[model samples]
Structures are given as C-alpha cells and as structure tokens.
Target: MKSRSLQPQLANLPNYKVRESHKAKHVNLKISPHHGLEVVVPKGFDHRRIPEILQKKQKWIDKIARQFEAQQEFLTPTAADQGVTEIVLQAIAETWRVEYVPTSNPHVVVTEKPGQQLQVRGAITHTDLCHKALCKWLAHKARTHLVPWLRTVSHEVQLPFEQASVRGQKTRWASCSQNKMISLNYKLLFLPPEVVCYVFVHELCHTIHMNHSAAFWQLVGEKDPNYEQLDAELHNIWRYVPVWVEH
Candidate 1:
C-alpha cells in the first residue's frame, strides 16, 4: 500500500506519514527510530481528522520521540553503515566474519567458507540483495539447528508437536498455533542457548495449553525450573541482534 506524507500543521508537532491498511480496524500511531512517526488508519478513514488526533496525542508523541532519540545510537547503524562485517550467534556459540566479493553474476549468492567465514558473491554492490542473501542463510542455519533442538526438547518433555518452521519475524521470537504448529524466529540464534531452550519449551508447552494461563506456567516451570528468570532475559536481548538482519 502507498503511504501519503502529511506536513504537520503545528510547528511544534513532529511530522508524520499517514498510511492506509486494509487489516487495520482503527487509527493507530507508531513511533520507531527507523521510520519516526507513522499514523496508520483503516481504509476509507477520514484524513481530515488526523491533525486533530495528532494534537491530542502531542505529549505522548513527544515523550516517545525523546525515548527513541536517547536510544538511537544503540538501536541500529545508518543505512550506509549496515555493511555487515561480522555475525555472532550466541545461541550456538559461533562467530562468523562476512566477506563480500564482487562478481558478474546477476544475483548475490551467500556461501560458507572454511575458518568460520561467510562469502557473499555476485553483485555485492547491491546492499539490499546482500541483506536478503544473508537472511536466507540465517533462516537455513536456524532450521538446521533449531528444528532438531526443538525435537530433542519435545522428546525430553514427552510433548509431541505437529510441525516446526522458522522465519525472520520482527517482533516475536516464536509462536505456537492452535494446531500444534510452531514458528520460530531465526533471530533467536542471537540469544543465549538457555534462553533459546526456554523458547523451545515455551512453544512446546503450547501444544498442550494454548494460552498463558497458570497451567501453562506450571508446565513450563516443570520443564525449566528457572523459567521466570530466563523469560525475563528475553525482554532485553533484542539489543544484541544485528541491525542488518532487520533491514
């Protein structure tokens, strides 16, 4: 969908872009370091009321803007600086140095070389293409390691799941569906091994309990005695994830 830019009527208010989403049921505001302010409204919503909404939420916007500004340097590097040089997968205790090689091929291809190195071949000058190649490789690695690990945990807990898949989800680390299909975010490779195991247990338990009720917690606790502490660690672990993965 195309997003329309709106100039702030009040000089003190920050500028925001207005976007229409078919899935949206009501107007929502999003503030991120990468995109700044965004006003998302449902389709056919009146655009004229945006300015008034912004005025009412002026203080909240200013507060969130300042918070993002404070964490700007820690969030992600600029686009020009996103040329990934090294990747550290704490979950598996592996580190890799990335090397970009230019070639005449039409597309980029990522290959693993000896000595813990990743070689990005083909039109390496195209930044976005390189990112896609890296993400694809990450997903492959996640599946190679995570799927077996999930199965091991399932067998240990005697909880059988129907299926497991991996993706580069932005906000969540993992999810379990009603039918026992679990989707794990490849980003979990950046987290600690114990926390990653907790995530596996978290989703596996969902095979029995669909909600986060006390019963679910009891089951998770039975599997991982320190579930509370491990779960808390996941809240702030996103800082360790490389910014290039998100781009």
Candidate 2:
C-alpha cells in the first residue's frame, strides 16, 4: 500500500518554518527568530521535491518574512543606560526557609532549619545560573503541590487530562495541547493556591476547546465563576517576581 502523505498546499500568505524533527517525523512548521523556512524530511524522503515546495511557498515565505521583521522591531527592548543588578541567589535560597529574613541588600539570609530552604543572593556574579536554580527549585515545589490540586479540580470540573508537568516557561503560565498534555509554569508557585487553581482550570478547559473563543471562556467560567478576577490578580501579583534566566 502507498504510504500516506500530507497534501502540501501553496499557502497564499507566508508561513513559518517547514522542518522535521525526530520528535515530529511528520512535516511540521514553526516560526523561528532568524530562519524563514526550515524544511525537514525523513531520512529516505526525496530531497528533489524541496525546491518545488519552496517555489510553491515563495509568496507565503515572503509575506511571513516581512511580518517577522515587523514583529522583531516591535519586540526589541530599549537599551538600558545602566546595568541592572540581578537578584542574589542566596536571597532566593533563604526565601524557602521558615524564618527567612531579607538583608539590607537584596540577599535572603536563612536561619538554621531542619528542611531545605530557598535562598536568593543577588551578589552572585552569575545571575543567570542563580535564576535557573531558583526556577528549578520553584518548579519542583509546584510539581509537588499543584499535581494533587489539579487532580481535585479536574474531578470537580469533570475534565480529564492525560498527563501534567511543571516547567519554567517565560511567555505563558499554563497551556494544554490538543493531546490533553498540560504544562504549568514554575512561576505559578508565587501565586496563591486559589489563583493557581484558576490558571489550572483555564488550561484544563483548553483540552476541550483548543482556542480562546467565547465558548472556551464560558467553560472556564463554569468551573470557577470568578476565574477572570483570579486571572487578573495572578498577573498583577506575579509582576513583582524577577524573570528567570539561564546561565
């Protein structure tokens, strides 16, 4: 029997990357910062067809490239006149302790405790490393606490999820894919449990409706009537937390 193939089409407008990955053997498209088109084929896939594909997609590629350029310009951050000091890692570590105290400087000093503590020491030269460590620690905590809460909320809302995990995501607090995979950001740990539940339910509802249409919001509101207010509070409260960066 002939193997099934994706009926590739000439997109009227420019699209993103057309690439293949071991994770996704199927032809996939993604938007990257630099490359306009990334075509990925299987090991035995014909390379000769690539040029034809590109030609067919030339108009789309050009339009998407221009849009990407415009978006890049808008996303550029203004240059800072002076360097901003990063939060101290020690202070972050100390914050986890029961009797943690913040010093005059942005450092967290911890009192001796039986269990582990989170500390933030802004004095550390490698701010990125410190921030990553902090994010990891926060992720661990969220995973421990949020999973059970998610299960309860899922049951209450009569929504089912295949799997749930926590990570350090920058742009989104939580997301649910079409496959019912749910991910929550470690930064969510900074929010109160009520707010966290609001985010969890919001993402969980996505498993039912993939887009943010009025129906999606209605589903979210059905679970938690005050979801909108809680979501707004979460965003406002999390604004004070420092951004997580990798070393």
**Using lDDT as the measure, which candidate wins?**
1
User: lDDT per residue, candidate 1, 99-191, as tens digits?
Assistant: 998999989999999999999999988888999999999999999998999999999988999999999876568988889999999989998
List lDDT for all candidates, in order.
0.83, 0.57
Q: How many residue pairs clash in each candidate?
A: 0, 24
Give the runs in model 2 whose Cα sits over 4 Å from its true position: 1-95, 98-116, 119-125, 243-247
Error of 2 at 121 (Å): 11
Model 1: lDDT of residue 83 = 79
Deviation (Å) of 174 in candidate 2: 0.4
Q: What is the lDDT of residue 204 in candidate 2?
A: 86
What TM-scores do the predictions have? 0.73, 0.52
- Would you give me the overall lDDT of model 2? 0.57
Q: Report the alpha-carbon TM-score of model 1 versus the true structure.
A: 0.73
Cα lDDT tens digits, model 2, 151-170, are 88899899999999888664
